[model samples]
Target: MLIKGFLDALQPEPILSVSQWADQNRLLDSKSSAMPGKYRTSITPFLKEIMDHLGEYSPVEEVIVMKGAQLGVTEAGINWIGYTIDVSPCPMLFVEPTKEVVELVSKTRIQPMLESSPSLAHKVKPPKSRDSGNTLTKKEFPGGILRLAGANSAAGLRNMPVKRLMLDEVDAYPVDLDTEGNPIDLAKKRTSTFAKRKIFILSTPVTKGLSVIEPLFESTDQRYFFLPCPHCGALQHLKWENLKYQYNKSSKVAKEVYYQCEHCQEGIQESEKTKMLESGVWIPTKPENQNKKRVGYHINSLYSPLGWKSWEDLAIEYEEAIGDVPKMKTFYNTSLGLTYEESGDKPQWEALYDRREDYPRGKIPTDEIAFLTAGVDIQKDRIELEIVGWCEGKVSYSIDYRVLMGFVAGDGSAQVWQKLDAVLNETWIRPDGTQMSIRMMCVDSGNWSSEVYAFCGRYPPSRVVPIKGRDNQITIISAPKAVNVTRKNKSVDGVKVWHVGVSLLKSELYGWLRVNPGDPGYCHFPMYDEAYFKGLTSEELITTKNKNGHTVQRWVKKFTRNEPLDIRNYARAAAHMVGMDSFSPKHWELMRNKRTGAVKNKVKKKSDFWN
Candidate 1:
């Protein structure tokens, strides 16, 4: 009768709501966070209603939160897990983008939640306890177990049935897992055995229609957190555009950021957000929201903590990102909680060709030139070269493109090599008769590796760099490494080859091609042959399943002859080598004055538009 005696001793406490329990017990520790304190629902009142849905009374089978970074989505999720452990223990699954995230969350979030809360600490045994079922990926309680896994692992998704499942950063999750149809569907199957199952999915959206969270949110009763203006007393949703301030062009900053009341036309300071959120309520556009078992909530960084991402902070970030394509994409996804829309396809070859400016092939106005870079594409029969002029805001002007006709006769002794040398040394005369030579040239080492190494070896590394196209996610260029197995496959001093991220540059270039002229990051097209535009627009980005059944994106050619695109990609890489990112305003003025040899009339700033 040991069990009976233990049951008698264990007194059943009064039932309390999840939020009520958290306010009375949950603690945030210094080990896991800087703001360590007891839990309070008032800090993020908008989430209390969402987290309480995990209780037995709520019928929501699914909850989707399309949120930005540092918005407490992860913390709210941990609260639900703790509530489950203390009140209604059941099998749960916590999934992240990868195995590393799973391990990280276990150590950072779950551990702190259990150790900091007395009720949860007493219910769940620690790792050292003899009967405590605690591990990095799995935790077993008296009646239930919590399992952790990455979306990439198929076996983990199918292993055990669960009553509660959470998928963090759902947009980053691989579209598929091995042969499993969909990771979401696979994870959903695990909860099928339990009649009362709860699943929570959250992420910052990726792209329109392709984002993992968008469709899920659209299908549910789409809900948004609406707050009443402190002055106007009128309820309205917080949006990025609602916040406004003066942008100082010279300083590259928004002077001040304050929300304008749409109804009263009064300014709302961020300091007042605390009170406004205290009176906030979530409104659902779909009336049948209560009827549906699934619900969705969307919130942006606008609702983040006061000191965390203030109105001015977000404003400055937007001002900086508006001029950069990749940064703008990130802003859309993270700051606004919106999906980035990729232009339908690479700019049509005809469109770019037809929009060619009056500028001659190689006579780009020196005033418009900030720096110059050249790309070389080596082929068995010939080599291709392209010179691109980069100005402020990354607006690149096509200077000239030429094809050298010859073959590699005997190890860098070909006429093609001589032509390439002449091209590299040739200076393009500007409108003012000032000459500008290529500052950096990238020669393709992927093909004709031995010959390319020999030709580039003849020149100093500062003048010519041997490069091969590679696919990377972070940046356009990777650190220089030993050339791919060469004639001897031996390392040479000062002989380093760069890996150009073809995929990264191609994506950025495509974005530039789509932006209208006069816009930041717009790429200028000079008078070029139809064939040149054809090759430039030859490839398009496509999403398809990889060998692991996971969805991936890459550029694929529609037809043949993509050398024009290749040269452009290489030129972009060369642009980085010549300080494309670090150039100061003084450098641009110096570059502009090189042609006329005129004393600086104006101290040009980085924000100045290209001439």
Candidate 2:
């Protein structure tokens, strides 16, 4: 009794107002206790960390958080919602990916917190009537109501007028719904009226291209907390490369370390990281005007009070389990607050850039140019057409790209003929009155053979041809042959015309296409697929004998596996067919000399013949 009285006396009498004492008692009672039937339970540290941030209201309009799995981020969000309801009441919407998640979160995380937290439970009253399908309005505190909706339903999100929007697991939200708009965009409309609205988009990283969370992260005002280096007191980003083992020679694995100071070159250990935490800083260095007033937090299980010790133990266990690689990159990035590149895949960008210069634009030769051919790969809805103008000693320029839509009619037979006729009318125009048309246009008749045949009937005997190949062995239906045409009676413009086979046109194109490295004009063809250049593998060009004992030299793709679109092969085949030369003599000689055991042979074939 004496000690209690002394402690009370020391507490500055006037400072202990009824409200201040009540607030302290409320906070003390809220701490978790082992006693049964204790209404006030202590909030978890993870939740407390988030609550602390919310406790300080700033001008920041949004918070963008990137988190690892199971760090109570959802629970933290729930607490924030409840806190807002108690203190600053506004119409808020909680959005989840599906109806199931919405129901689960409301029942499990939100309801329990409001019921248990004495301060919050006292402020917000119960719902008027519990059974409303479209609206579940609970008058918890006084000023406003909290609305819950699933992003999965467009009508549910679209109708709400929300001041604060919490989009949960945005990465999981469906990008495109046939009848409804994108869920994220639909949710954003709910808060369009409120200028001082708060928006929180939180999600774990998913595969690169499609995830909706990417846009929020790219925003200017989104602040990422940067930790300073304890060793040198420099502000630096935590990266995976900075962390290394204590002994480089003895240890094969890298230890958990922070980036060294750029000036001092000293490593920042995890134990000393507490000094570096800057609570409110934007990431990626955004411009002042474009900033959205945001803060980001990366949460990991290591920060959880429940699993704190377990995290340390698991780190040791994981070191033994797989040498060094974590189950997912999120494990390292989230726990250590560092960034890492996605592992295990080779990027296709490099291969495309390597051969970028090889394909260039050039003038169409007047005298030596023999024929033009088009290779059409037709699909059900779309068609990929590559048109090659063939000359004897030049690289073929892809002059036209046509992407056509609409369904084909009559089992695609009539449609193919119509498309072929349209293509001929649009592309095959002669300067003179003579019918200057492609010698032959090859259609991938693999899927629609009958359609190809029907289309071919519209042209002269050898003008339209079908390509035949199974398992990458492509061959023209008719070999290269010439058809003579002469005017019966000679007139001023009357002249003889010759129709050539598809193979003859291909042969002409092959010689004409040449790789000129120095000329930018010939190097700037943008239509070529970048993936084709990247996937090219070094292979042995072999001469093999056919069944008839004829030696045929074939340049085979040498990769261990085959890619869906072998651009190099297609380009080479297109070049071969159109008589486009691979490169000039000087360039070819340099390449030949650079390669080991490369032989230069001058034996001219039909494909190599000029005019």
- lDDT of candidate 1 over 68-171, digit per residue (tens): 87888778888888888888889999999888889999999898889989888877788787857798888888689899999988988999789999999888
TM-score of 1: 0.74
User: What is the total number of backbone clashes in candidate 2?
Assistant: 42
The parts of candidate 2 lying over 4 Å away from their true place are 1-57, 70-75, 123-141, 246-263, 278-284, 288-326, 329-611
State each candidate's clash count.
0, 42
For candidate 2, the lDDT comes to: 0.46
Query: Which of the numbered candidates is closest to the native, going by highest lDDT?
Result: 1
Alpha-carbon RMSD of each model: 8.2, 21.5
TM-score of each: 0.74, 0.44
**lDDT per residue, candidate 2, 1-611, as tens digits?**
99999999888534222122223333222222232242221323323333444432445667666665555466556655765665557788888877777877666556655556676666654434353222232333466767777776776677758888888887667554435667777777888898777777787654333335554566434343454556655565444345444423224344453445565788655555434442222245454525435655554433334323233343543343231122233344445433332231232444435544343333232322334556665566655565555432343344444556644434443454456556655433323222234444555555644444344433443444445433211121224323222222311111112122222222222222233533221322343454333333322234455443323333354454222222222333444444333344455344323322212222122221111
Q: Which residue window of length 10 is worst by lDDT in model 2?
A: 602-611
Give, for candidate 1, the lowest lDDT window spanning 10 residues. 602-611
How many pairs of residues collide in model 1? Answer: 0
Q: lDDT of all predictions, in order shown? A: 0.80, 0.46
